[model samples]
Target: MPVELVALIGLLVVFATTTLLDVNMGAVAFVAAFVVGSLVAGVPVERVISDGFPAELFLTLVGVTYLFAIARDNGTITWLTSAGVRLVRGRLVLVPWVMFVVTGLLAMAGAPLVAVIAVLAPVALEFARRYDINPLLMGLMVVNGGAAGGLAPSSVLGSLSNAVVERNGLSIDPGLLFAGSAVFNVLLGAVGFVLFGGSRLAGVRTSAREPAVVRTSGPGATTAPAVAGSRLNGHRLATLAGLVVLAVGALAFEVNIGVLAMTVAVALSIASPAAGRRAVPQVAWPTVLLVCGTLTYVELLQSLGTLEYLGRGVAAVGVPIVAALIICGIGALGSAFASTIGMLGALIPLAVPLLGDSTLSATALITALAISSLVVDASPLSSTGALVVANSPESQRDRVFRQLLAWGFSLIVVAPVTTCLVFVLPGA
Candidate 1:
């Protein structure tokens, strides 16, 4: 049996064990990585730890969760949620759209997609809890909105996609790519809104009367209402300042978000030891474990050449259009588990041969491929989906994870076929 096939089977088993036995997927992934890397791949343990484990992503998850925990503990999240509610005039349905637009604009302004997600998801989930809205709906809105905006002409994904196409000697309209991605995402977001109880939430409004003072139990806990005259005190103010610093540092300065976030979190901890003590334990450790473990196993698969093996198989298909659709499917499936950028870099080049046939429109094919690759970032295993899961209320995190997994897997099938039909067929 091919080693890649065995690794692939192991990956499925990890998911199945997690689903059927309610085991921590991350823990299972870690074990899988160790076993596969050691026995089958002949990779040393030291190399596995150094190469497979994603320390940067780990830091990002830890830092963001630490900061968010402090915000939740200090009433900053409550204040922000209440303020958002007031801004929407207590219209619950509009809140999700507001998040969508806000994240979209940030992405359009050239913010990295993950940075935008890190900045907004915690707040968005908090808003969902406060308003009795569906967290899945809100999380998906934020993710889709980020993707939509991330395809803007000036955004990182847009610039990179355009550069790749141009470098390959294919002419593409940047505007068309942006418009296609944005419209697809917006339409998808609307679908999520209606399918996930958006219409039911619209008529619901917060009471005019102030509710009793309630405290959050812990991370992912239900939040309490803010006091009538609640205001940011010194600690909350400092925490907010830290968040601003994180944003500016990440977006403008292009600093590594994980390191910068950790630096800010550490500073905040030093400033208020008591608050820090309370907040440290609230970091989403389970989520951290899950993300790190899954990604590590994915890295193992990459190291073992599973991805390349799969890519070669797709490229070997005979028909150009059939090959194109297969390429799109690979992109969708690969991007769901790995980095979308990495998948784009790998798969787009594979499609170059098909494009060279001169029977397909480079613009349409590339556009379809790009959107197909990107739209699956909502999968639970992807960074955006993991962030959403990490920030969800604990009681609902499992449900949210399952929902995202189902959604992501569905996209792996639907997105590629639909995009192929829409973008590739007409041109062919």
Candidate 2:
């Protein structure tokens, strides 16, 4: 077979392989690209390897994830969640929207995965109890809201995407970024409200009991031994202060976020020896490995001309139809996998070539990506999904997962359908 045809086959294989397996799409992309580069495309293996790492993308994910972890240790996220819950009592219909704003803002501040969960889970549980609503219903609201938070101006993914685009010589406007994301956020929020919130409003409630043994064990469990680090004090203050400074500087001063985040880790480590030791164990290593592996996959895909093929194919077909479908597909897949940064990192670059001539700019693509991120947030397989289920008593897990799964798929369906009609139709 000819090199171009072989490369094309490889690209299709990668898409199918990743969709069925839990493997990183980036890794699939990298391997496919590398094979094509060597035997098919005739590009040098060394060049493929060099580009495979995508240092910027890796740094962006690692920095954001780590910074959020540190922030979680400081109890800042708990305070934020508590504040939001306090403000929106007894307003069943509006809970999703409120959750959206709070989580989105916290994500912007570089709050970590479990930090987002740890803080929001309790508040959601409390809210469900107080309002006599289903715990799972409320949990979905918080997870979806937190997932939607990735759309905010200062979110980890938003910042990373903006930097990548700008670094590639494309100018980006923050206003456009925020506006497009805001629209996407509102659309996804409504989906959650209807699927999850509407049920609660109609008087569906869960009978989940508080666990008889309240010992911490799983994901959001505060299971670690009650040591000096358990108490929030000077150590908390310094760690949080360092995180704020680093996060603010990265966004405000345009400093490298990864470096700033590492600096915070180092400073915090030195500030309180015991706390530093504890934080090391607390960081989510699986997520970190996933990020790195995914980056490798993305770079490989680019090298293999897989994305170029897709982009050119779309261009050949006419931008309107292809672009709309691509955007929606990206959203659904990203939501399904529950990693906005990973999906966006993998998708956006391939998309840039396709989108250059389309009506949607990088900002618009970012918006669509943000919508996909939110969709994933609401999915039952997401880390947030587990977080929500774990927050309730053992019995409510199955029921809650089912309800949220229904809502998640509904949003995935409604969001793209609506976009095709509203956002894409106008532009396309």
The lDDT for every candidate, in the order shown, is: 0.85, 0.55
The digit string of per-residue lDDT tens for model 1 on 89-197 reads: 8888889999999999989998899988988999999988777789999999999999898878899988888888777777888899899899999999999999998
List, in order, the clash count of every candidate structure. 2, 9
lDDT string, candidate 2, 115-149, tens digits: 56544564565556445556765676566566555
List candidate 1 segments past 4 Å from native: 207-228
Query: What are the candidates' C-alpha RMSDs?
Result: 2.1, 8.1
For candidate 1, the lDDT comes to 0.85
Q: Which residues of candidate 2, in runs, are more than 4 Å off?
A: 1-45, 67-96, 102-184, 193-232, 314-417, 423-428
Worst 10 residues of 2 by lDDT: 206-215
